[model samples]
Target: MRRVYSIVVSAGLAPALILGACLVLAVSPTLVPAELAGLVRYGPFLLALLGGVIGWWFNRGRAVFVMALLLICYWLLVGNGAGISAEGLAFLQIATLYLVPLNLLFLGFTAERGVLNPRGIARMLILGLQIFVMLMLAGQPDVGSALYRVLETRFFASTGVLGTMPHPAMIISAIAVVLLLIRHKPLETSFAAAIIAIDAATVMGAGVIQYGYLAATGVVLAGLAQEAWRMAFVDDLTGLPGRRALGHAMAELGNQYAIAMLDVDHFKKFNDTYGHDVGDIVLKKVARELARVGGGGKAYRYGGEEFAVLFAGRTAERAQEPLDALRQRIADNKITPPEKSKPVSVTISVGVCERDEDTTDPWAVLKSADQKLYRAKQSGRNRVVI
Candidate 1:
């Protein structure tokens, strides 16, 4: 939770700083170099495309990923006032300031699922309706003026505590951003930031669009991409570092180190007797026990039914106590399978080897540990053999 909170806070603050800078630049365009003004003017679409690409990459072709395509379309259609009646473009500008918030809300509500689900379908329908209304209102300035007058008369006037944003749209947007931050979905948070930033650009009247908004969104997308990379190296079933990660660990280990190769005894038999689902639970339980091993041990899931524990700068004898304790914990643990009447207990066989005169290479030490593990299995499992 703390990690999630920190991530949310960081993503939230990034957009705030970005939008604030945008507003400042809008006020004092002179502070921005004339050379960079062209980039600021024409860079939003490209940056929006970059953000979309990053989001698509992290999500991995999920249906919700198509939102990126639609987002690009949104930039092309409404980002700049173009190819529309002057009065219609004015209406779109006014409508989009409020509509973007709704789009963000829709994105947050359906971050994982696509339009196939009920919530997603409904939101998309309403969003389509909003776009249709915006299109209809385009080139209709007299209606826009009259509608604002009626709306102004109907709603009760209220003053904001912060005088900088007295309008209801700004207050609603602020509330939406806070709510999205609380959800802690990285891509959703970034999407909301981009929407809010772009809308703020519209409200500021500094320019037709602010490319900085897309740039900020791209930063958030980059964070999501990083998380995706981390997830790639993590084992899905046992939540441990995978075999590839174990290779990395082996490469990092010093000459003086102990490697322990462990495997759940009769794992295949257990899987056959119980369902694979229960077998997965057993693996997860054993993984938890192995993860708690001490003596500088770091555990990894080294392929099916097998795991590696690396004790950096420790001898096999020094690491024996922790390994033995881990074996005992797995033996004693009572795991209840889903829809099963009784709890089942499982055991692990460990083979430990330390770097020595005969085994200097990490792989050599690992192979030695594996051989010892095979010996333990032959001599009745559930014990550590060195």
Candidate 2:
């Protein structure tokens, strides 16, 4: 299941789906009902604004404010503000539209829970506002028709360049990609950055920039859904699948399977000696190792220093080597506490159980593993009992 998730995310599935939706509109604008088509054209702004509002109400209120700022910045740049029709201006300078979304993406990646915070968002907005003002000033800089005129004059002249010297759009694009690659949620960030790149290439069509915003919004929506799923089914401390996800996994498993219950040895000592913070670090490290256990096992955090590893289509005999190796690995890894130089190590005791012909319930098999886990813990922890 995790492999499938990695594959889908790496393949850019979310943006692909949104891109498909956008293409349908671009291709068959008539396919939509008259009312819907009008909504598509006129309602997008309102709908996107509404989404920002909804985000605020959903405790992602911070993002709504950022969205509002971004919307205002975009409108200021693209809207009919100076009595001079924006339509009349050559789009060569319009590459400036990339800033707002790029700003949001960078801010979003830095935001807590993926929602841009007020202080950070404010700074970005202020900076973005200043940049927009600068662009407006650079509008007729006979200083040059473009920044890096050498790129057009001497370098790749066919594809050409946009904006003036110190090309902010290209700079932001490079910075966005680098930042996204380093951030925790690289896939989503990179997806938004990729969309921005495509938007940069088609900046002439003003409408394309809006599509880029919509695509960013789509990523935000998908992120919300993924967060909801994580809160319910992923263990916060260990970053592993939780009990709810374990139940779902078992539901899809074949009858032939082995399950193991693991408990961190002397986990209470960590909390007593250091704090839950250190305990959390231990759990996360332990889960990380368990996730890579051999024999095609899947790991889950089964609440409070305890973990579960399920090996579908594998018997207890086949699962033993991996379970024991997992035990040995946990025993060997030294966990370093934050702000402390001394490294400490912990171990785990595991109990493995296989589904029998008479046992139809996977939970019952899990219970068997649980019982054996207790026995292993009782008989001097750090070994696997099957």
Candidate 3:
């Protein structure tokens, strides 16, 4: 059940759900109010702008670039109001179909260096160059005609559900989807869904194209929101829930819950001797052992070398065996730092307290556990005190 929950939350299900809802609304246009019908035409552009602002705020370079690129593509394809010739419009459509997925592929592999750096400015310049080239092609009948021929040429026979999509564009989109799946991070999963929606729009006709773009933009935006939430609540180094998450969890604790506070033995001294890099490795190793604790325990990083575990329905007495085992497992493990032939040992001191008449408040229980942890450290570390 826990594994299933993790998969549901981590596998980009939020974006997938958003895509499903958008598809439903797209197919049942009558479900949309007649007064708000114009939203279908303008909503994607608005969403792209909002997404760009969010990306910039989060310092997610890929989101900023992709959103800007998508906004430009949408403008040229639908919102320009330029009264472009039919041939020019066709050329722009083909160009956008190819460009969007290609850029998604490139940006997926690109590192996030924030939105205002030199690399980011270079990315923007490249996008501007592409936009300029696209406009030049659209304005020149002869050049646009030559490029359109190449873009429209079918490389293979089209059939089945996606037959309406151009062959070259379909191939590019498929490759991008496959690569994004291989990456399989939340943002990449969202990008894969967006590419699939764009391809479906090509096949489903113009009436639903706006809905497709809406789904694409909406899913990516949702993904950014999820990433931001994770950054707020999850510890980056140890992959454990952070102190903030621990506080949230404690707020809803049951009457029989036990809270265990743990601190690395001699961590400051060890860090100074072995350096911070090796110190991080030791913390991660300790976290891994703590995460495997039985008795329904949920481990969290409670700032620096301090950690916590909550056993929701268990008292300190009930939680003792597993806590002791966790302590022993961590003590048994050895970490070999770089340039060291002998492996160094790492251990922790734990203090546990359960909810009782005198300590009904969760914070009070946590403080008692922290005080016990200090006792364990003073009583010749590498032990558990309850």
- lDDT of candidate 2 over 1-386, digit per residue (tens): 75476445442465567656765655555677876754554433564486576655565543454455445544544455453333323332353445454655655565444336656456656666765664564455442244324222322233444422224455556666566545655334533544453454244354554444455555555544454455677787777889998998988888799999999999999999999989888888898898799899999988888889999999999999988988888888897888999989889999999999877699999999999999999999989999
Pitting candidate 1 against candidate 2, the one with the higher TM-score is: 2
- Cα error of candidate 2 at position 21, Å: 4.8
lDDT of each: 0.68, 0.65, 0.85
Model 1 ranges off by over 4 Å? 1-32, 54-59, 62-80, 83-212, 290-292
Candidate 2 segments exceeding 4 Å error: 1-11, 20-36, 61-66, 69-98, 113-166, 184-198, 201-204, 338-342
lDDT of 3 by residue, 150-267 (tens): 8887866767755676788888999999998899777787788888877777777777888888888887887677677677888989989898888888887877899999989999
Clash statistics: count for each candidate: 2, 3, 0
TM-score each candidate. Answer: 0.70, 0.76, 0.91
How far is each candidate from the true structure, as Cα RMSD in Å? 5.8, 5.1, 2.9
Highest lDDT, which number? 3
